[model samples]
Target chain A: MIDEIVAAPGAGRALLDDYLARYAPGARARGMVLEQVLVAPPVWLDDQSNTLTIRWSLANAGAWWGMRAVSGADSAVAAWWAEVDARAISRRRSFATAPEAIVRLCDV
Target chain B: MFRLTQLVTLADRAARDDLAAALRAVGRRARSLLVEPTLEGSFNGGDLLVHASFNAAGDRAAFELEAQALLGRPATASIDSVSYSSEADGREPGLRDGIYRVLLLSIEPGTDRDTVARFEAELLAMPRHIAAIRNWRLSRVEQAAGARAWTHVWEQEFADAGGLLDAYMLHPYHWAHIDRWFDPECPERIVDARLCHSFCRVDRSAISSGG
Candidate 1:
């Protein structure tokens, strides 16, 4: 899964930091592994904000379901995201898999 | 007559069974009550499904106070409810023990009338696909008086709960064909993904009476 957050001007780093500090732990507990984090443009000058990208993944379909069930039961997970919505300009989470894995993934 | 259908998520996972048991005793508060845990098919199904009938609108306004303590704050993480004057097919609600299944959903905002009508027609035709639906009722919400203004309420009585969890879920028409309208990623999607698909034990018919 890929999470792309367009942060407000000068807010990208803080947004990324807050996500790591406040949301990552709960996500990790729910069996999602943090794959990578990136900031667009890499460097930020005055009045410039970066687009923060977070990549998270689960080992398998069962792990995916387990993570969802755990996260779904936690109201904190949703509350935290609602707060994130205010900090960022816009955010989207997209899920994808390799073409080779498509057939296997649909087995569920 | 007023019909209220609510799906409640518990702040505490342990609170599910207790809430179900508590709701069962409150049947006297409404003309009828069907409360139970959702078996599957939705993330928002919540811990309890509270389907009740009221003699008057004010009756529910009064009982919702008691419901606050039984289903509100502290114990609840979230709740979605709707109140409406129901529409029912005039079928006799034969007396027997059965499973009461309620599916509440909202069609995405801004869909065209033709598409919405087609979607509703397809959904109302489910009994033609699955024989297990012993009795059924499909109603458009007359009052959009819910946390979410659900567009439709599709309810059915099955001979057993397993019939719902198994047959209705696994049927070819349901999973392969009709599910496209409810699937968020599908191009044919109509209903929002946050649907309330829940069922509970019932000794009598919830369909014939609520309207």
Candidate 2:
């Protein structure tokens, strides 16, 4: 899962921390291990949103689906996002797989 | 030439293969027949599709009568059938040995004509972004007589199964743009959820060879 966050000038760091602190535990419990967290520009003052690209990984498609079912059933996972939605201007989450696994994962 | 296509929902899922075989036998009486069970990625699409073409226009009625009679043997739940000539035939020479996909959908009743036109234009524009759609046709259903009042019959022939399941379905234009009309969550959605999204493996061109 990747999150594109559009926020006020310097609030991205706090928002990122808030997400990591609040959502990370639930995410890990649901079978996702935070592989990496990187904020573009590290520090930007001009006119640009500091996009947070957080990535996670699982065992395989089976584990990913298992995580989805578990996460879906767990209300805290969605509740956390609902609580945090007000802080960001716009937030979007996307699920993707590595290009090498596309043929096998997407069943193309 | 007349092409008669029916998206059928069987009362019993176990009898699908047998019913498909029986339908294939009935379809053979026509010039060409493609009776095959649809693979996954189907929303409200039926169990299988009965796609048959006739050389003479009058043969359509006779074939339909026979096929309709056979429907009672297995106790079909419902069927959405369309008989139409290729209204917008784009039989480009890209892929002959490919799969044929057909989508039957009804525009939400009472949608403004301009919005519906835009929806169709956006739908037709899909091939521009996704080149895998080898042969395509977007036709207004001449006669939509079935469980639902279908308005449009959009079909595409891809170079291969991947060209459909992957390239066509996953393309950004399909989900990001064209999908809004089909997605119930989107406010721009105009299509009803009961859509017949069915496809079959066809080594030959189902649209071009219908005549």
Candidate 3:
């Protein structure tokens, strides 16, 4: 679940929120801040290849600090970058998948 | 997340008896007691008459008797109020919808017989209750409709936890229940089993009953 969640766009918000909720004092000391939440539609680059993308941003130093405090600096940096890419990819995929999911939901 | 209720199947008499017993045992030892009745009404999908409660030591004695009678478990029991709740009641009832059966308990860590037993029991009972309600026959279609009306009620009293405040403002009962079952920290647990199998079997039921 954590893996998939991190792979999700706007996952940074969730992760940041969780960190603050569980470790607000540590978050404050680190300058963790959540700048925004972005949910993108599923994208389908091609019917054959089938790719996805998502996009999001953050404004607070705490966002990075929060990640470092919770996951450690090295892993935190990796997680932050992962969130950035995942958000963009998820958005692209959502645009591609939304119609299908909605159709499936309705048809089923 | 997909509603877990979709996987439920009705429990037989023997099963219900066993579940009742288990519920009764736990109810007997709770610290506080609260009963949320599942009124037979129509709203969300239709109402599923559920008598959920929280009971601490004061009400534990009676709760234990009832829950044990409902589920058949005999382990050391302790609990708080039963947060009795039902689907919303406003719309008409129908035969196409499913009902809900919920079981929430917080046993002391390391004290429970099998951590997942009670959780599974409650999860399994939902279908049984739905099946029982569906089996009842009413002579007149309208009369039967009316009879089914209160069986499942739908209400939107539950708040949506989206933004930060939304998460913070969640009712303590809801959070407590979630924490007990879903929280990563606590080994203690609460189980809520819902079944929408009926809805899929038939067409869309009235949404007035709480879904």
What is the C-alpha DockQ of each candidate?
Answer: 0.03, 0.07, 0.04
All candidates' TM-scores? Answer: 0.60, 0.63, 0.23
Query: How does model 1 score on DockQ?
Result: 0.03
Candidate 2 per-residue lDDT, tens place, B3-94, comes to 88898888998888887887777766587788878778664567887887787777888888878887864578888899887643554644
By TM-score, the better pick of 2 and 3 is 2
Count of backbone clashes, every candidate in sequence: 0, 0, 106
Interface C-alpha RMSD after superposing true interface residues, each candidate, one decimal? 7.8, 7.2, 17.3
lDDT digits (tens) for residues B1-211 of candidate 1: 7787888888997988888888777667688777777665544677787888889888776666567679777888888777777556534477368777778889889999999899888877888777777788787876544446789888888888766766676554565467667643234667865667777767677776662
RMSD of 2: 7.3
Expressed as tens digits, the lDDT of each residue in A1-108 for candidate 3 is 011223343344444455345443443354533333332234322222222212222232224223333433234433543444444333111101234443332221
Cα error, residue B166 of model 3, in Å, equals: 30
Give the runs in model 2 whose Cα sits over 4 Å from its true position: A1-108, B13-18, B91-96
lDDT of 1 by residue, A1-108 (tens): 677888888888888889999889988987889999988988863486689888888786556546655665566766776787787777776666788976555432
Task: Provide chain B TM-scores across all predictions.
Answer: 0.83, 0.85, 0.21
RMSD of 3: 19.3
Which candidate number has the best TM-score?
Answer: 2
Docking class of 3: incorrect
Worst 10 residues of 2 chain B by lDDT: B87-96
User: Which regions in candidate 3 have their CA more than 4 angstroms from the true location?
Assistant: A1-105, B1-82, B85-92, B96-211
The TM-score, computed over Cα atoms with residue i paired to residue i, of candidate 1 is 0.60
* TM-score comparison, 1 vs 3, better candidate: 1
